[model samples]
Target chain A: MTDFKNLDISTAKECLLKKEFSSLELTEFFIDRIKKSNLNCFITNTFENAIEMAKESDKKISRNREIRDLEGIPIGMKDLFCTKGVRTTAGSKILENFVPFYESTVSNNLISDGAVILGKTNMDEFAMGSANTTSFFGNVINPLKSSEENTKDLVPGGSSGGSASSVAANLCMAATGSDTGGSIRQPASFCGLVGLKPTYGRCSRFGMIAFASSLDQAGPITKTVKDAALMLQSMSSYDEKDSTSSRKPIPQYLDFLNFDIRGKKIGLPTEYKVEGLNSDIVKVWDDTINLFKKNGAEIVNISLPHTSFALPTYYIIAPAEASANLARYDGVKYGFRENSDDLEDMYELTRAKGFGDEVKRRLMIGTYVLSAGYYDAYYLKALKVRQLISDDFKSAFEKCDVILTPTTPNVAFPIGEKQNDPIEMYLNDVLTVPASLAGLPAISVTAGKNSNNLPIGMQVIGRPFDEISILAAGKLIEEYRSFL
Target chain B: MSIDNKTVRKVSKLAKIRINEQEEKKLIEELNNILGWVDELKKVDTEKIEPMLSVFNESMVMRRDEVFSETSDELVLKNAPESKSGFFVVPKVVE
Candidate 1:
């Protein structure tokens, strides 16, 4: 029997095909585990639907029919993705009772491929936070034990925190996470999992709740690089619904595994060594470079000079876009409604009460930046700086095939550590945002654990539509992720 | 760039959200803390770089010259907080 504790997708597929276990049996195991879980990882549970779907898949296996890519795999969908007839909260009270009448393209794709929908996982309210603390459903507790003594409840890094926690805890085979900045990779790092954020337009943004449309893209968080490849193969497709989606055909992602490093150029940027990075993380970062060099990769010292400005520039642009996107959530259309006799008062009351503190803070920041007289100095200036940040990657890619860095400056901290200070919370994404601004494909691989046995992740960033290169590098790093 | 209560109020008004006085006082400090980021962003020279709004650099997607939604108003209004006679019920807009 395969171990239920770490049931990765690759093994699950093999186990099902070999008749070692039925999909119904596997789905029941996950459902039972989720029922006993205390992690607060899911916002809504859908066991009945999952069981029904699993039964249908069993028939196909019994008849020896050609199986689909994600056939019968029970995975968690981050609440940000709209599921038809299922509640999608985007982790906010505003959407507490809102159920989508239609499915998101990615969720539609996942279902079309015969994947069972487990339930919606919790996330940051409107995907605005670095920690899961901002979730209206409450914080998701990291399953990994904090190496530090007296740290009882460590936070799963987020807005993909719940998705990461579920996968890491083995409550599900794998899960989906939407990365606006470091949402997917950070939480994956914190939980000792593999997470990938495909190039900005690789996955369609149609059904995913918009945080910052330009920056948001969904990807798979899993136990192995191969699992992420299998999930991405199903999630990614060109759609007319999302204009930014690329027409570039997705290569069979698994084909890129065992990516040869014999002649690959790995770029190491000096700027990622920012102030206040955890020394343990730096050690892991250095070790990753050495591992690459030993594998016959030519290492190049490159510079992404505009890297420091990426966080602030992201702060400006993302909030500006968020404020605009979230405007549709006023009392009338759907979701929660605050009763007010006056029309204007109803909009204000519903929004004020429905949104959390962090969401309001971002909306305020967004409104302030885009208001009259501040447009050129803040909003437009941010756009120009964004271009410079994007250009830095263009030039860096000209010299190298991939770039490597630490996913987070530190391992997962106990929840409530940075909750009060928004700037500190914002600083968590400093390393990951530059790649987002450039629309490059980046993946985080669990390299090793720190003194507290908390996980540390190494990031591999690839050029535009070049997910294969990073997946290849990630697979290599996964093999022998030596750390001090 | 430390924001005052007046500007915070104005911005909140623009965003159409309400805030209490205590929340207002805390927002001032929080917004000021974030100003440091913008201050750093100002140091960079991006005078010649063109502003980028979209990343794919693709032209606008020509919408299919066909009707998208036809006879689906009932389904669209399924989640509305209040609706009547095939239209969303809203409070009086004009005095």
Candidate 2:
């Protein structure tokens, strides 16, 4: 039996190249684990498709043909991305049986690069909630159990909960994730994985089920920073299908991993140190600063004063866009339909029955903000605050190469703990939302473990399109902390 | 910023989503709570700030005016809940 737990993407690629293990064997190993796993990480599994793809990869290797970057690597796709002929639920009951006829650009890119599709991992319905509990498929249980109380179950932080959980548990070598506010980073923080939300427009959103169009970005949630870079390289490309896709040349991100950050200016935003941050997390942050300082990096204090408004602004903008985007899921089109006597009744019934509580709540909030009477008071005002938040990062980046902060206020909380209170749940993304609002590239890497043995993650925020700098900085943290 | 049941009903109607009496009451409370928190945005001074429509300042990309490949009707209606000969079947909106 292969030790799948210890294998990372880079090492797995080398072993496959050396003929030590065929891609089919690797695929079957992961597929068997997925079938027996108790964690509800996947919403839909494509084991048959995975086996076929792996077989093809083995044939290519046998023929001595050049292999692609992600060739034969088993990876999880967040259920949000539309996979042609496979069920793409987006963790919503509305899309429970929705099978896309076409593939999302990111998934298509992965397939073209020879990556095998392991399965579609679960997520917050329509990527709305901070915790994965809102998923119609059921909440993804964090594999990191509490050391203090074994009976207490931890939630894999969400809305990218399943992606982070799968990577943390070694269910897959890596997985893809989407971040609107803090979907990728927060979950990565909770699960002790490296999750990167690249600069907006870096990856095409052509077939990603829309959440907040402007804020939504596809990124990688992986076991290591190097794997993230490798996956991201294949996932990113300019697409005409998505109008917002950037035409900027995608850099070979793996090449940037070797560069030293001896004199890199690291910023510490004081505003991020909110009132209720756990003291243990603070200790971890301080320890990370010392590690960077030892590496000859300069730490500078900075202020993103408008940070307080990011959460409020995100709530307004994300839902507003969601309200418009999700309007397409009426009974006449794809997805769940509730039969009714009238057209209007059918529309109402289908949406009501199809959406979950969080999705409905967001839809209503979005509708209210964009309504005739409150547009200026709520939605328009949010757009202005959005500008201020983006400008704050713009100025801060002038003095720093990368900004360092704790990814979440604390480690993973027990499932159902914060599910009822939306306000309490929104606070989980307080440190992460600013970067999303600014459309900057940011990554969350495991810093250390807390007293309960739950992993703590620190975020490294970089300038737009400057993912290399943050990746380099993240690698430093990973290396230094592994030795500790 | 207080949301009442009437407002919830009105918003649900606008959103084309049905809510029962119980759900409406719950929604009213949840909406009010969320709106009250979001009302803090009104406190920020934005006298001269332009509303940011997108993070990227780039204009909409223009493609050459040309016909793309046509999608088959079967593929187009593959996921539709109700479909007829090359068209979706919906409740009659026309009188």
Candidate 3:
């Protein structure tokens, strides 16, 4: 029996170095698991390609060659990333056969470090939905072990649901996930793992399929916080190819893993203590606070009064940007084009056949908000509210090193539950959207399991370029909890 | 906060997506709910706040307007479903 529960990168690295197991053996372990489970976690598996890469890694290790960092390690790339010569579907039929000639900067960084590609995980089409049900392929179920027999079970929160599910189920060591709103953190919260969304511009967006360009940033989803740190350290680098990539110096994340957080001040946003917060969620938050207090950390209550408007503002600004970015796929560019009689017919028919229902809804909302007369009323108003929210964080950071809140208002709901109600689906992101709108660094760390055994996460949010502080604070929480 | 059927139809057309009457009704309900939720934002006083269009603090850096410094092979055109000789093909507009 191959057991790979919550494996860390350093453990796998030690195994490779000691010759206890080969890269091929490790790859086979995951590939076989994928074959047996048939969990809708992945959209495409490059098994033959993965094996070839593994063999090459083995040859290097045998030659006493200085193995590249992350050598022989396999990672699942989200389908939103553009992989050269591999199908780069963004969980939509529109780009089903679209093969990117160029590799995304994040993937390129992974390849340069000798990380082997395992497969492209599934997601909500264009990273649009909070739940995985909007996927063109099918819903990706939560991989949590359940005692109930007849219950359909919970959703593996999305739009990066596939990434979280695969890592939680040990289908892959670590996976890449894009967080436009709550894509990475929500899934991580639902599936019981650590997920990080770095400050905007910390990671390059060169070849990532754009959702909301201003807000979309890619980061790591993994079991251990240390592995997530290592992965983010590798993936975050200054690239001239991406204009938005930060020119700031990269810090050694692993070096700070053992640093103590004694006397570090943490804040709890008063606005987050709202009316409908699940009692279990509030209990987790309170428990997390006690743990932090016990670790010699100072806790304060800060006000981010702009929290209420964040969800509405995010919905407006994100879709408005998506409408413009997605206009490139007009049936004439590189994507699936349907048969039509005239030029107009070609565009209309192709788009009508290509996008799913949720995508269309967003596009319409986007167009309406950004249109001539409504721009001032909707788009501009949302932008103003967005600024107030960012300012709210800036003010809070002045008084505290980090802010704490619940990752989501409640636990994961069952599949086919929120499909009929789009508003409820959007509301799942309420607690998460504020951090995203401000482009702050936030992480979701598994606090504990609830009465129903579902995982709940406590979010740690920090100022821009202060990701190290957030990680340090999260480590303090994890240490207090002591290896769950 | 009420999004009428006519408004939903117009927005769908503007968005370049084809929708049936059933979808239009569904969209109206959904949009109305969204608008009702968003109306809460009006209560907040954003009187003095400047709108943040982009997160990057940098504003409008100028670039050199140099012409045709170099060009790569137009390999992107090859992936298109329909293309002519070295150019994208579309139905004749001035026939």
Candidate 4:
């Protein structure tokens, strides 16, 4: 029996190329693992389809055809991406049974690259919450239980919680995740995985269910930075279907993972060392700075003065966009519909029943902000502030090649700890949101483990479309810590 | 900038999401809590700054007006909650 858990994507590809194990055997290994695991990582398992695809991949390999980057790799996709003929829930009842006739550009790109689809992973409803607790399918339990607090169930952080958990638990080689305000990075931090949210528009958003369209960008949650690079290469493509899709050339990111950080300017934002930051995470940040320094990288103290406004700006802008994007889900074309006597009643009832509390709260906040009287006061002001926030990063990037910070304020907390308090929950995205706001590529890599043996992650923020730099920096840390 | 139950109800109506008396009470507290926190944005001096419409700072990529691929009507209606004769079935909008 192959010890698939010990292998990363690169080594697995090498094994596949050398005929150590067939794609069918590898797919069955993961399918069996998924059946045995209790992570609740997947909302839907496309086992039969995956097996069929893996069989086809074996035939192509035997025929001596050119293999694609992700060929024969069994991977989980966040439920946000619409999979043709498979349920794409976005972890909401509104799309609970919604099977798309079309595939998302990202998923289609993955499929075209010869990747075998494992299933749809669970996430926050419409990718709203910071904790995965808001998912309609139920909360994904973090496999990393605190050694000290063994009684409590640790949460695999939000929105991309399932993606992070599955990759961490070895259920699949890697999985896709959509990050809007730290969904990818925070969960990656909590679950001890590599999560990369590529520059906005680096990956097309053709059929991914819109959360906050402007902020939402799909990337990968993988066990290693190199796997993230490979998954992202397969996931990104320019499509006319999404207007925001970048026409820029996608680089062979794995080629840039040499970890030679000589003379690389790494900026440490002083504002990130705020009062409430856990001291352990601060120590990890300090240790990371030293690690980079030992690698001959210059660590300069920088200030993004507008950092305080990021969460507020994100809350206002994200919900405003979400209200607009989600307006189409009035039980008209797909998903759940509530019975009512009148059109207006049906629309209201269906939405009320379909959406959960966090989603509803955001929609209400969105509607209120975009409403006539409050438009200029709330939405417009928030957008202008967003400009300042983005400008701060632009100015900071001019001075430094990359910015480093703790991925989250603290390590993974127990599942139900912060779900009730919205503001407490929103605080999880504070460090991760600035990059999303600027449409810059940011990656979270495991830095160290905390006192309780829970994983902690450090984020590397790069310039717009400069994913290679951040990936290289991430690779340095990934190697320095020997995380892989 | 404080949100009240009345404001929550009005916004919920505008959003076309039904909030009951209990939910409205809860929403009022939650919305107020969030809005209170969001009020910090008002402190920032954003004078003369243009509202960012998008991060790309690029014009929408438009294609020439031509039919590219023919999507079957059945494919479009595949996920509909209710449909009949290649049309979505919904509560009467007009009369």
Candidate 5:
């Protein structure tokens, strides 16, 4: 049996095609890994369901299959994406028993492409927290060790922590992740993998549990950049299901994987050189720049002067949107509906008990900001600042093809470190929130390991529908660093 | 400025989240800290600047305003804490 731990999508495809392994065997291997690891990576494993899907894939493969792009690949899905019949809790008690009747577009697309659903992975409650600790199920442990002998446990960053952790641990080959602000990239960075947050509307959002709808775009978290690209190719398509899905023609992301970046103008935003940035992070970022230079990519200093407002602006806008979107779950819809003597008590009791502390905090902040008295003062003001932030990125893109920054200010902190400080937790997305506001594509690829051997990632951001150039630049950094 | 206890209770009611006396005391302190930091936005010269509502600048798209749309899915609505045949069952706002 091939070591499922070491297999990437390319090798798996080759092995399956050569009859070295059946898709059933591959699916079983990862399913077995999930069973043994007990890493809190999965909240729900459709083992029987996956085995049945694998059997069908085996039949197609044996029939000299009309090779689906992601044919026979097993992918772990973040629980936030709704899967019909299977429980999708969004890692919140409010959705604990909720099984969606319809499949999310991303999940449906994966099913159509012959990707086996390995399981539903864990996440922060309603995809709210940066640290995985907010999960109702439990925190997912970082797969990488502090050292071979010392397994000093750290949090696999979240709210897509389970997706990243499972991929890093080889629980599944590649997984689907949603990035609202820095969800995918932060977790991927922590777990040492490639996480892509596509240009807003690049992937259909239909049936994906809402969390800041305008900002949430589903993308793949994978072991290799090529695997991520291939997954994106299969996952991204214009869907009538999602009204906001971009009508822009899909580009062959993998076709440009080997493209030359000889004359590429990479923009480095000076505003990211703010105070409190870890010196070690800066070192890795500087090294990544040097590697780009060695590969003939020119680097240019760019300014996104309004970047300082991104965090506050995001807090206001995302919560404002989330507050509105999440209102659907007000004890009057599917999921946990508490029974009380009176109707008012039922509405008050259900939500109060269903949502966790962080979700409640966000809801309160959202409601407070969007209330009639506060809308103009809080939400509107933040929206204007958001525009300024987007404008800053747009103007910078005019100067360069892609902008680069540290994906997270520091490497993943210990699990409980930031749990109590909401502001500190919110600040974790400082380097990432700006891109989301602009509806641009951004990714975090592992640049290098820190002193503790935890991975540090640097982000490459591109203009709308310019995912190719971002991936190209990412691959360049990956290839260039492989030599060093 | 420190948020008063009564204001904290009022905001809590506005937010639809219940806070006990002890929790309210804690929330009051936390809200003050957050408000102090958020006060920085007031420093910006947004005097003549227009406030942004949404990202896309689309004006009202005309459609058939008289068209009837389903208020709620029966199965979904039935899952609520309290629901009538085709509507959400909520407390009577007025007699």
Candidate 6:
């Protein structure tokens, strides 16, 4: 068997250009693996489409044409991204047969860069749960298993669990993931992959199935830090279609990896070392910083005073936005519809059957929080706390160039471990949510493995539009054996 | 604030999703636990901080008022589960 496991974008591009192997060969290698994969990481497989795409890519390569950024690469498209004429479910039964006429801006960019789409990866329905368990399709189990712990089946952390698993398990070259609240980073951490959630407004959310409009941003889940930089360079853009997307120039994120990290100040937010955090993660995090210090980087202690409030604030704000976004799925214009004589009955029954439990729970919470009388106490107050949390990141940035913390509180646990309790499941986002609430760029760099053999990740957060510095810092961790 | 059965029923109606007795029972316990956990937000004294209405707080972009799309009705009604001519045919709003 060829070592396609470590075949990253940079290497694959070289081999293609050097005629070591054709894009068709590489695409077939992955398509074969995906067919054999029992991870349940994909909702809609596009193998036939992929074969056509790979053929088209070979023409471009043989003509010695101006090679595009992601020329001939086979990548996973998270089901959240709408690929025109392809089944885009967003991991919900409602949109099971939903074939979009238009493509999402981010996915369109990747295709334009000459990438072949292998499949639409599964996710938590409407990107709601921290575990992949909530998908209407089925639970996406983590490819990683710890025999020492004797766990039967572990969950790939979500809502980009499929993307993470597909990439980490080498089912695809890399994948695109959308992060509303650590969807990209958390899953990547669990699967020992590098996931980057670009600063909000970095990528337009024009056709991404919206979970939370304000916080949802598109990014990459890849096998390596450099691969993440390459994918993001193709992903980020400004569009008039998305009002929140930044008009700021999309920097060559690939150039970020070349920058030196010596003498850069990395902030360690004390609040992240909270109660009941995994001892294994804490050890890896401390060792990662010490490695940085040895490499001539300065470590600074910073405080995100409102860090404690981020999760509560996220649960409130995200659900409130989701309630409004999901209102469009009423069985009328598109999606699964339950036909009833009464119009309102149709709406009620369609939604009752269309959405899974996690989604409904969020919708109800959103309805309650934004309902009459409760608005001030729940939704309005959450907004105020959101501002405070944003300010905390701003102040911390002032003290240091970037922030460093553990990507998740703990490593991957069994699939059913936290599913019964919503609060426990939501706790998985605690360390990652603060950065999301503030709309900053954060990457989960996979550090060394634990005693139980699960991967640990260290996150490096940067200033607004400062993806370069954070990528530079993340590259250092990638160099250290701690991350290898 | 903790939600009870009455509130769940009201909110479920507002959300246009039906909640049967079994689901209602599970929702009450789950939602109460979640909301109870979320009550930790009250600990923060948000005194005079303005509610954040936007991320990055950038001013909205203004575009010239012109029809940029000439999308056909066929395209618009392409995905409709039920359609008559160019219009999406939902359950009748008025008898």
List per-candidate RMSD values in Å.
Answer: 1.3, 1.0, 2.0, 1.4, 2.8, 1.3
Query: What is the C-alpha RMSD, rounded to one decimal, of candidate 5?
Result: 2.8
Q: What would the per-residue lDDT of candidate 1 be over residues A371-425, giving only the tens digit for each residue?
A: 9988888999999999999989999989999999999988888888987788888
The Cα error of candidate 4 at residue B8, in Å, is: 1.5
DockQ-derived CAPRI band for the predicted complex in model 1: medium
Window of ten residues with lowest summed lDDT in model 4 chain A: A475-484
Q: Per-residue lDDT of A1-484 in model 2, one digit per residue for the tens? A: 7777858899999888888999999999989888889889999999999999999999888887978887789999999999999999999989988998889999999999999999999999999988799999998989888788555778999999999899888888899999999999999999988999999999999899999999999999998899889988999999989999998888989977787899999999999999789998999999999999999999999999999889999999999999999999898778999998799999999999999999999999999999999999999999999999999999998999999999999899998898677889999999999999999999999999888878899999999999999899999989887653
C-alpha lDDT (0 to 100) for residue B39 of candidate 3? 74
Off by over 4 Å in 6: A1-3, A482-484
The 10-residue segment with the lowest total lDDT in model 5 chain A: A475-484
Candidate 3 CAPRI assessment class: medium
lDDT of 3: 0.85
Better of 1 and 5 by lDDT: 1
- DockQ of every predicted complex: 0.78, 0.85, 0.62, 0.83, 0.36, 0.85
Q: TM-score for candidate 1, please give it.
A: 0.98
Error of 6 at B85 (Å): 1.5
Q: How many angstroms is residue B91 displaced in model 3 relative to the true structure, after the best TM-score fit?
A: 3.1
Please tell me which model should have the higher lDDT, number 2 or number 4.
Answer: 2
CAPRI-wise, candidate 4 is: high
Q: What local lDDT score does residue B91 receive in model 5, on the 0 to 100 scale?
A: 59
- Candidate 4 segments whose C-alpha is farther than 4 A from its true place: A482-484, B93-95
lDDT of 4 by residue, A1-484 (tens): 5769947888888888889999999999999999999989999999999999999888888886978877799999999999988988999999888888888999999999989999999999999988799998999999889898446989999899999999899899999999999999999999999999999999999999998889899999999989999999999898888889988888888767664678989999998886689998998888999998988999888889999999999999999999999999989898899988799999999999999999999999999999989999999999999899889998898889999999999899988898678999999999999889888899999999888888889999999888899999998888888532
Q: How close is candidate 2 to the true structure, as a TM-score?
A: 0.99
- The C-alpha local distance difference test score for the whole of candidate 4 amounts to 0.91
Clashing residue pairs in candidate 1 (N, C-alpha, C atoms within 3 angstroms): A147-A452
For A1-484, candidate 5 gives per-residue lDDT tens digits of 6677778899899888888999999999999889999679999999998999988888888998676777889999999999988999999998888877678889988899989998999999999988788999998998787754644578888899999999999999999999998999999998999999999888999989999987899999999888889899888987766667777799989876667888888899999986788888899899998888887889999999888878877887888888878777766667887777566566667777888878877776777777767777778888777777777888998999899899998887776787666887888898988898888899899988878777889899998888888888888767665554
Candidate 5, overall lDDT?
0.83
